[model samples]
Target chain A: MAINTEKNSYTVIFAVVMVVVVGLLLSGISQVLKPNIDANKRAEKQKNILYAMGVNENQGANDVVFVSDDILQEKFDTYITEQFYLQGGEKVDDPEAYLIDIKKEKKKAEDPSYDQKLPLFKGTKDGKDLYVMPVRGKGLWDAIWGFVAVDETMTIQGVFFDHKGETPGLGAEIKQRYFMDDFEGESFLDDGQFEGIAVAKGNNDPKNEDKSDNEVDALAGATITGDGLATMLRKDVQKYVPFFKSLQN
Target chain B: MGLLSRKDANLILDPLADNNPITIQVLGICSALAITAKLVPSVVMAVSVIFVLGVGNVIISLMRNIIPSKIRIIVQLIVVATLVIIVDQVLKAFSYELSKELSVFIGLIITNCIIMGRFEAFALGNGPWKSFLDGIGNALGYGLILVVVGFFRELFGSGTLFGIEIFGNPVEKSGLYAYGYENNGFMVLPPMALIVVGIIIWVQRSRNKDLIEEN
Candidate 1:
């Protein structure tokens, strides 16, 4: 009340000082918490990869429980035997391949000259070899991404979908166990030809009993997100067909 | 009651009903509709709003004297943004899963009109303690309406509460579904939320004749 707060000079000075103080505070906090956040992200990635390969602690039908955080490293190490990437038809082993930013790689691969390094995790679950590949795409509201685990025949063993900002109870239901479970036993190849699975509406297979048809029953009120998922599978999963075919030879 | 006087108690209690933020003031209806489709997200949004508003009000009230009236709006905005970011970063670091669930809603908290409305109308003039109480009161009021709306929306819209099936499995045709009852998909949409809020307002006004306005 005593100070002349109405002055333009006073207003400008206050604004500048406030901005500086807030900026410093925010930056300091972010710097200190970066490690923890990064660690959480890494653990989440491991969990998703493992989940896709069906190495989880799910006890109930609807549960999507991942390996616990305490033993996450151990589980990841034991199950994920190798982390590698496919670049220009060559397999390159990379310990940090799982950490590759799919969004950045997708953007860079837009140019014809860039050979995008598609990261894939080779894991052994229940005495069967599984390859988990990460896929990213646009959803109804924002970005949607997931891990798809397939066998040598490119048949889907399992999948784990996640979204950044999809509508809850609608598009967001893509991550639910029921939705993700439908992808199991679905093959990306139809008679030795690449045929990406579709999240089709009116497929009339609500029970998802017909996996060989290359279509899964779509979530109601989530047409755009379902289409996005199908497109994402076609665009990203199609890239690994050569690698799987080489394995067969 | 021992800690606060009747006047101070009113600051924290009045907004819960007579001056409810969503139903009465009509502030922050956007979020009330957006996240209230489910009970879990609605509760989370409410708790986040309570924390941000409480801390924000106190900060604004403390800086009330020095804040230039010309740029006070900008200052308030900065405070809300800063608090929201801090909350978001901390949640990401400590509770990553929860932070993911609340991804967009936390940022949406910055745009909540109730935060700014309180900062301008109450915090700029009131003392810090009073402002904090006011913030808590308004947020609770908003949250009450949100929870009520969310309860109906999730139950009718999805046949569930907090993801727990109340009417058994619709797919299996059990419980209410056996009687040929179907989940009202319209109840999940945003427009339905508006209608639900309108119904609440109508019920409240009818019960208390004092709430009705003569135009």
Candidate 2:
């Protein structure tokens, strides 16, 4: 059978072949860049954690330090020694898996393969042993996630907050250092007790002067976001109070 | 089909001016509005679209014959998707940071109607080279309007180009525009792009009476 060029244009076949060629080309490129992209993501997550804990300046998104993979592991190891997970008040079988990809588990709950667990990262800064817990929930406009590091006694060491689709310059201030810096040295426990932090209005001047230290000032124009952050922190941090107490014992 | 080529060019070019995509067609209004807030990204988006539209047209046109008439749309889609992915991957590799900023918009190029429109109307019937030229032409036509609208938006919106402060900020560290010195809160919003595109349409119609008649 002779294929006639008279009726069938070689252009058509050429284009289809080109599509397959280009597809394979892009796949190859994606594979080559895969490690760099993955490394960038991991570095970014670590930088956010460090920034939240007041160890690094919150310069801006995309401004995080891009250290080599080896250095990153070393730096992360210096701070985060161990991690754990809990169910009700008992320890889960494999808490280590939670650290593999917290973002994955946080995004979906239907995956029974992932046991619902809170992964804790143990870190020591200035001779203080701090436990970092990841919390995620809905904000005013989109998803909000953060890392809160608490001392063995459960004093809040620092906090970092990130959101998607929040109003920029207003609710988005959660990403700003000024806002996160306030979380530093702010006690989660007030009056030798763990009532956690309260997000309040008007400088957070509580009626009870004693509770003021446990209050974080509300973002001027972002009431819903502030309240949402407070609500998320209250519920999530409360879950680990028993586990944190166990560490003390 | 010989006589059709002449008629087709007229039909396509007519919509570009009289039935303008951004203003009249409003087909790709989303990116038009969002990216216009910043000059560089808007320009980048425009160029990227032009590349995709032009190349997609050429590819689809070349494949017009053996495209199996029943599943033509699928063939066009495969070609378009392939081009979009290539562009998306290229953007990520070279401009990793900017790619993150653009986020889903790059991937959404697959859904862009201008690209699909070119494939359906022109590429499917034309030769490879003509389809390529027509793709570039339509993309150029689309991009022309975007840059013009984006110029005004970025100038007044943020007083910056590619995030560089073009208009020397004032004593209060405010830009040339007193109202929108810090940032044009309005320009960042998607609706502002619509308003800019709307004004461009109004201007085009007022100048070209032919456009008004079509409207």
Candidate No. with top lDDT? 1
Put down candidate 1 lDDT per residue, B78-139, tens digits, no spaces: 99999999889998999898788778778999999999999999999999999999999999
Docking class of 2: incorrect
lDDT per residue for candidate 2 within B12-107, as digits (tens), equals 575467656666666777667666666777777878888888778877776666565655777777777877777777776566656766666777
Question: Best candidate per TM-score, number?
Answer: 1
Q: Please give me the DockQ of candidate 2 compared with the native complex.
A: 0.14
Model 2 sits at a Cα RMSD from the real structure of: 6.7
lDDT of 1 by residue, A114-232 (tens): 99999999999889999999999999989999999999999999999999888777999999999999999999989989999999999888999997999999999999999999999
Per-prediction TM-score, please?
0.90, 0.71
The single-chain TM-score for chain B of candidate 1 is 0.96
Which digits, one per residue and each the tens of the lDDT, describe model 2 over residues A3-53? 443444554774567578877877897898777666566566776566555
Off by over 4 Å in 2: A1-33, A55-99, A103-117, A122-131, A139-142, A150-157, A164-185, A196-228, A246-249, B1-20, B23-25, B89-96, B147-155, B166-183, B207-209
Q: Which regions in candidate 1 have their CA more than 4 angstroms from the true location? A: A57-61, A201-209, A218-221, B155-187
